[model samples]
Target: MQTGNLLLLLLVMIAGAYYLGHRRALILARPLGGIRHLHSLPFYFAMRSAIWSALPALLVLASWLAFENSIIRAVVVGGMAESAQPADPAAMNLVISQIQNVASGAIPASFVSQDVAQAAEQLSRLQNLSGMAMTVVVLVLAMLGSAWAWLQVSPRMRARQKVERVLQTIFMVCATLAILTTVGIVMSVLFESMQFFSKIPVTEFLFGLQWSPQTALRADQVAAQGAFGAIPLFVGTLLISAIALLVAVPVGLMSAIYLAEYAPARVRSFAKPALEVLAGVPTVVYGFFAALTVAPFIRNLGESVGLSVDSESALAAGLVMGVMIIPFVSSLADDVITAVPQALRDGSLGLGATRSETIKKVVFPAALPGIMGGILLAASRAIGETMIVVMAAGLAANLTINPLESVTTITVQIVTLLTGDQEFDSAKTLAAFALGLMLFITTLVMNMVALHIVKKYREQYD
Candidate 1:
């Protein structure tokens, strides 16, 4: 049976185990007057049975699936003649792929060697047998576990304690997996970035002024060892993000304040949702809007005023990005603002303070930390944005701070560097990991700064 269908059957068995356990508990309790005499609740007994029926079967199924293919491949390869054996990892991979293709009918048997065809047949047979064995073993284990739990369901059993311990273990395992996954990502990127920095000096990458990444495919080919200056990319990212924040922060904060404080209930209900709808619109749609409408309009306006504006300027991308992130700042700020103690506002008003005065003196200070956090989130979103920048901002790695001129961000360059078929051994390709590492560091520093600010103000307010 398929793994998914087997899982469904396991779930059905678990459910049946739970029902049967619950019924048995009731039958056992009826002769003793009531469930109050039992050590734990009937629900715990049912849950314990369900857990027993599911956990062992799941573990066995997972282990089997994890090792099944490798074991099958080893067996198939071992069965082949000594001369047919692969000599290396690459050759082994090629042989395996050929066998898999033949087995899957992507390649016909008559096209391949006799040994490979025979191996494909063996592969197909082993796969079917493995599936059948897995299905039977998993089902049998589940049934045995359920039967054992059914026999163990007694008034004296500490079913609640057992169930709680099992749940705690599961939660801890999930948390550990999350931490390990994050560490794995950081280590992978860090290792690749170290390799990149080995090829390109860290000083040259960080401080140089030019930003070309094109390199020759072959050593014999005549090409410049491309400039890997990252200063232009950094400047462009900051320029656009600064512009976006300038547009987003005040407007979003003001809208949030108005919605949370001054607006009528009906107006707030309609206006807030309408404003937030901008966030739900896809980034590609925003990119199209920026490219087709905002960029052209900005260029036309600049030309009419005797100023130069590139067809794809950072200004257009920034404006549209700001619009896209408004909901982040507005929604978060509004929630924090509303969460400020109403008693504080009332006390300020009682002292003859105006509504605006109460907001400025009593509420805004209390909500400042959350507002800063919201702004930081919006800033991060703006920094990481790629689709809008790709569509609206041209990929010119110019070092100028001119918002009217075209610019590109680190994310855009990362996408550009790794878009098509490329060798990871090349500095050009490895530069993507370097760029990603820098971006990660930049974000981490931003988070630290923001946290420090939030902590300082939060402590004072608290």
Candidate 2:
């Protein structure tokens, strides 16, 4: 059967089973006259049964779909004669591809022998047969299990509680998976970074001022030896991030204040989302804006002021990144500020404080922790941002603090290191991982500090 037809049939069966379960639940719950006697309504019991029935079969189907190709390939490869197999693995793979193409009718050629053709035909038939059989068996088992569950449903079933518990567990598992994924990524970065550190000393990477990532592609090429110092790149990253923060923090905080404290209901509603439109603008657009508009303006301004300026200055990139981060800071800060107890503001106003005074002295101090948290989060974002720096900030890794000079960042360096033709096991690729690890660590530290500060502030307020 067609895949769509099979899916439709499965869905129909599940729905039919659900209806049957619902009816069974009603029959079982007939003894409970009033709603007060039962933990949940009969339909909830049916829903529980339906979910239990469908979930296992769906899981089986999904797993089968995922692994069936590999299993079929393995079976076909194993059935091939030893003499027929190509000596080289790559050639063997090509032969397997040809066989599969011929079997699927993509290659219009008859098999030299009847045995090979027969085997290919049998393999295809077996795969389809197995998939269909598994689907049917699983569906039947699910229906039977659902029917049994429906039979077990009674006034004392506590179906609602059971269903809720199952859902809560599923949610917890999903959350765990997310957390585990992050941990796995961090671990992978750490491992590769460690491998990099083995070849290049950590001191040179962290404190050395020069940044060059070019390395020899082959062992025989002795001419290429690349510098791996990260200080200049890190300095550039800091410069750009600092610039972004300088632009973002004040504007975002002030905007948040106006929206939370002074704006009228309609104005607040419109302006808040309007401000968020800045956040919605893609970073690539901001990158070109930095490169095309901001960089030239800064260079011209510098030249007019009798200072030499590079076309790709750090100031432009930093300034644009700051603009990008504003909405993030403002939106988050506004929410936390608004969430601050109204009672605190009311009391401050009652004590003969002006509206501005109340906001500055009472509201601002109370919301300071949350505001700091937002700023730190924005800082993390700035530190990690790639496109804006890549486009506007020149690739020259100058260790100078002068924003008018060309500067590079860790992210930009990482991008340059891994791009183009490169070996995975080389120092160049490994350096990318080290930079990633540092970035991860920096963000982690910032987040922890922010969380601690927010917690303390909350404690004081409470």
Candidate 3:
């Protein structure tokens, strides 16, 4: 049976177990004057049965699926000609890929040796046999667990405690999985970045002015050990992000204040959602708007005023990026502003303060921390944006603050460096990991700054 079909079967069996367990609990209760005779609720008994029936079968299925490929590959490869034995890791991987491709009919068997063709046939047989065995074993274990759990459903059983404990364990397992996944990502990037740093000095990467990552594929090629200095990328990222924040923060904040404070119920209902619709618009659509409409307009206006504007200026990209992130600021700020204590506003009014005065003195201060959070969130969004910038801002890693000039961000360069087929061992490809690590650190610092601001404002309000 296919894995998906087996999973469906397991769920069906679990449902049957739940029904049987619930019915049994009710039958045991009826003779003793209703459900009050039971130790716990009938639902708890049902859930305990369902958990037992599902968990063991899932474990078996998961384990089989995990090791099936490697075990099958080893068996198939063992029967091939002695000359077919892989001499290295890369060769072994290539052989396994080709074998799987032939088995899947992605590659013709006639193209390979008779030995390899036979191995592919063996692989196919083993895969089918493995699937059949897994289906049988999993279904049998599930039934066994279901029968065991159903038999244990009794007037004396602490069904609620058992069910609760099982759920708690499941939650902890999920949380642990999340933490492990995060650690795995960080370690993967860190190790690759270490490989990159081995090839290029840390100081040169951090402080050098040039940002080219192209490397010569041949010894006789003209490409000089392409400069790895990352300063230009950092400067471009900051320059564009600063422009985006300048455009986003004030406009979004004022919109939030007006919506939360001055707008009527009807107006707020329509306007808030209408503004948020901008957030749902895809970033690529914004990129098109910037590139096709905004960039050309900016260039035309610049020429009329005797100023130079690149056809793909940072100004156009930043403006559109700011529009895309407005909802992040407005939505968060509105919630916090509306949450300010009514008593604070009343007290300010009692002290002869007007509506504007109450807003400025009593409400805004209380909401400052949340507003700060919203702006910083927008700033981070600006920093991490790639699609809009890639489409609108030309890929020129120029270290200048001029908004009318074209520039590229670290993310753009990372994508550029790793776009086509390349060797992972090459510095050009490894440089992407280093750029990713630096981006991670930069955002971490930004988060720290946001937290500090939030704490400062929170204390004043408290």
Candidate 4:
């Protein structure tokens, strides 16, 4: 059977088991008055039976799913036998691929040999048998679990509490999975960055002011010593993000204020979603617009004012990014502002404060923490943005703060470093990981700070 079909079958079997268990539990509880005499209703007892029956089988299925591929691969490798093993890893891998193809009925006559043919036949038979055995075992275990759980149910059973605990465990497991995924990513980046740091000194990378990444692959050729100083890239990121924030914050906050405090329902219903359209525009589209349209317009405008400006400038990219972030800030801020207790605004109005005065003095302050949190989140997004800066901001990493001049960012640098032909162990490739690590840390810190502020604000309000 296909993998998807197998999975669906497993799910169906589990559901059937749950139903059986639930029915059995109701039957067992019936002599003692069943659900009527229990602390929880009959359905809760059934639900508890169903959950207990399904969970163990589900855990087994999950474990099997996670490890099946590796186990199968190892078995296949070992079954190749000593005589068929290739001396080289690459050659052995090629043989393994051919064997797998033959087993799967994908290999043509050109690749077939007697030994390989024999191995393929054996592998196919083994796989089929193993799969059938596993399926039977899973179904049997599910049935046994259902029967056991069905016997456990009684009139005195705390079914509701048991179900709640199980649900809490499931939620905790899901939360742990998310946290572990993040931790895994960070660990991978950290290890790769360490590999990079070993090749290049941390002091030189951090302190050097110039930024050039090109190096010769040939040993005889003189390679340029790459200046790994990240200051310029960071500055460019900050400069562009600052400009974006300047553009986005005022507009987003003002729009949010109008929507929350003054705008007619019809106006808000139409305008809020319309403003969100800016957020939906792809970054690549924004990149070209920044590079081709916005950059030229800004350069022309700068020239009219007798200011020399690069065609690829930080200002253009920043402006677009700011436009991109406005909806994010405004939407979140609007929700927070709306969530503020209406009593505060009513009290301020009763004191003779105008709508505008109440909003400014009472509503905005109440929602400021959440608004700041939203802005910080937006800032994190802007800092990590790659395409707009890559297209509009030139690669030359100049430390100057002139928004009209060419600039780069950490994201752009990371992209350039890792793209095309790359050796994972090389310093250049490792630099991308190091940059990723730094970027991750920066965003993590920002998020934590935003969360702290929001939590404190929530505590105050509560």
Candidate 5:
């Protein structure tokens, strides 16, 4: 049976089990005087039955699916003659791919050797047998589990406790999975970065002034050793992010203040959603606006003032990025400012403070931590922005701090480095991972600082 069909069948079985368990619970409760006398409610009994019928079946199904391909492939390969068997891992992979293609009709049996054609047939037969076996096994397990749970159901059964424990365990497992995923990502990046640093010195990658990742992958190919300096990328990222923050912070904060504090209900209702709509617009659209409209305007305006402005200047990218991130800042700031205790505001005013003074001294300080968090989020968003930088700020990797000059960021460089078919063994491809690690560190530091500020002020307020 197909996996989806099996899942649907399992759901039906679980529902039927639930109904049986509930009916039995009610019957037992009637003999015991009432459901109030039972250890748990009928609802918990039903849910316990459903959990029993579903959990074991799902676990078996998942395990079967996880190893089904490898098991079938091994059986098929082992059936082949010794001379026809693959000699290396790469060769085995290639043979497996060919067999799969033939089985799927992407490649005709006549196009491959007789051994491969035979293996494809064997693979198909084993897969069908495995599916049938899996269906039987999963259904039997579900039926047994359901019967056992139904038999155990009684007026005194602690069904609620069992169900709650299962749910708590599931939640713990999910949290562990999340932490493991983050650890896996960090370790992968760290390993690849180590490989990169083995080729290029850490000092050169960090403090040196040039950024060039183009080099030959094979020893026979002629190319530059490639300047691996990342200082230029860091400068570009900071310059653009700083510009974006300068524009976003002031405008978004004022907008939030007006909407949260000054605006009437009707005005806030209409304006808040409209302001936040900018966040939903795709970054690529912002990139196009920057490249086509804002960049040209900046260039023309700069020429009129007799100043040099590159066609793809950091200023153009930063301005458009700032506009794009305005909604992020505004929405977050508005929520935090609105969340400030009304009592604080009332107390400030009761002390004969004017509205402006109350907001400046009382409301602002109370909301400062949250406001700082929003700005950190916005700055992070700005630093990680790739499309706008690529479109508006050309990939020149210039080390100058001038906003009018063309420059590139770490993200843009990472994308450029790993764009097409790349040999991971080469420094060029590994540089992408090194850049990723740097970006991750920068974001982590920003989060740490923001969290510190939040923790320090939150205690005072609480």
Candidate 6:
């Protein structure tokens, strides 16, 4: 059955079970002089019945959806004879894609071989049969589970305990799945990075002075052994990020302080939303602003002053990125600043401190951790920005501290290397994974450090 249809059926069954359970609970309690004889309330009994009806059927539907695609593909491919089968898994996937396209009417039947046409027909029939079977199985399980729970619903039944345990189990499963997903991502990237390291020495990738990655396909080709030095990309990433933080931190923090603390209620209501609108503007739109407007303006301004500025300069990209992340810093800082106890501000003002002095001494100190967190978030956002950097800063990986020069970052290089059809064994493609690993580790370490700082210095103003 379609996932949506199965969900609808489950919901209906749960509703029906709830009504029956409520009625049954009232009937069971009536002989014993009202619901006081019941172990728990009517609501808990109904909820227990509903949970029983929904959980088993939902599990069946989820299991079916998860394995449906792979099972169908295997069955369709297995039906072909050994001589007619694909040579490799990759070719088999391609053949499967064509069959799917044909089956879905994206490709005409005459466009494929008769064998493939027959396989597509077989695939459709199996899918139909599977759907019908799944519908029957799920519905039956829902009805059976509800019936069993209904019969078991007596005055002594621990309906509250059973319902709470089910919910707790569901929550635990969700949390475990999230942790597992993160670990899985880290392990996958680590494995791919090891493959990359096998091709290129760790030292060369980490500390070497050059950044060429174009490996020649033939011995006679020019620039045969590509340089894999990543110093330039790292340097460029740091330089642009530093520029962005410089622009974002002071402005966003000051604006946040003003809006949250000093602005009148009417002004605060309108101004905060207006300022946050910058965050809502798409990054691509900011990229165009950087490329078509900011970069050219910077270049022309430099030329008029008899200075050299690349048309696509890091300064332009960084400025635009800083602008993009302003709301990150401002909104977070505003929230934290506002959360500071009003008593602290009152205490400072009672000591004859001015409003500005009270803010700097009492409010700012109390909210320091949260402000630092906001700055860290903005820094991460700046480092990870790609579209603005790609459009405003040219792709040349120059290891220069000067913001006027064109440069590229790790993210930009990763995108460049892995843009087209890639061979897993090549250094160029594997380098993307290595870059990803470094980026992940860098961000992870930064988060740990920020959390440590926050924990170490945070004060309870209350």
Top lDDT: which candidate number? 1
Query: How do the residues 1-462 of candidate 6 rate in per-residue lDDT, one tens digit apiece?
Result: 676877787889999999999999999999999999999898889998888898898898889889988998899999977776899889888889888988888999899988888889988888889999999999999999999889989999888998999999999999999999999999999999999899899999999889989886555767567888999999999999999988889999999999988899999999999999999999999999999999999999999999999989999999999999999999999999999888888999999999999988889988989998998999899889888889999799898989999999999999999898877778888899999999998899989999987887684443
Against the hidden true structure, what lDDT does model 5 obtain? 0.94
Segments in model 5 whose C-alpha atoms lie over 4 Å from true places: 30-34
CA lDDT, every model vs. true structure = 0.95, 0.84, 0.92, 0.82, 0.94, 0.91
Cα misplacement distance, residue 58 of candidate 5 (Å): 1.8
For 154-257, candidate 4 gives per-residue lDDT tens digits of 76778789889989999999999999998899899998988888888888777767777666556897986777777777788889999999999999999999
Candidate 6: where is the Cα deviation over 4 Å? 15-38, 216-223, 459-462
How would you encode candidate 2's per-residue C-alpha lDDT over 1-462 as one tens digit per residue? 555766777787678767876787666556666555766876778778877777777777778778877788777767777766568887767766776666788865474344456546656776788777876867776777677777777777888888889789889988999999999998899999999999999999998878777788787887677888998988888999999999999999999999998899999989999999998899999999999999999999989999999999899999999999998899989998899899999999999999999999989889989898889989988998989988898788888999988898888888888888777788989999999998888888888888898898878887
lDDT of 1 at 37: 75
Q: Give me the displacement of residue 294 in model 4, in angstroms.
A: 2.9
- Local accuracy of candidate 5 as per-residue lDDT tens digits, 1-462: 999999999999999999999999999999778899999999999999989999899999999999999889988999999999999998999999999999988999999999999999998889889999999999999999999999999888899999999999989999999999999999999999999999999999999898887788777889776999999999999999999998999999999999999999999999999999999999999999999999999999999999999999999999999998998889999999999989999999999999989889988888989999899989999999999999999999999899999999999999999898888899999999999999999999999999999998888888
lDDT of 1 at 396: 90
lDDT of 1 by residue, 252-345 (tens): 9999999999999999999999998988999999999999999999999999999999999999999999999999999999999999988989
Encode model 3's per-residue lDDT on 367-401: one tens digit a residue. 99999889888988999999988999989988888
Q: Sort all candidates by TM-score, best to worst.
A: 3, 5, 1, 6, 2, 4
Candidate 1 stretches with Cα past 4 Å from truth are none
Estimate the lDDT of model 4: 0.82
Clashing pairs in 5: none
Backbone clashes in model 6, listed as residue pairs? none
Relative to the unseen true structure, what is the C-alpha lDDT of residue 215 in candidate 3, on a scale of 0 to 100?
89
List of clashing residue pairs for candidate 2: none
> Which residue pairs clash in candidate 3?
none
Q: How big is the positional error of residue 125 in model 5, measured in Å on the Cα after superposition?
A: 1.8
Identify the superior model by lDDT, candidate 2 or candidate 3.
3
lDDT minimum window of 10 residues, candidate 5: 216-225
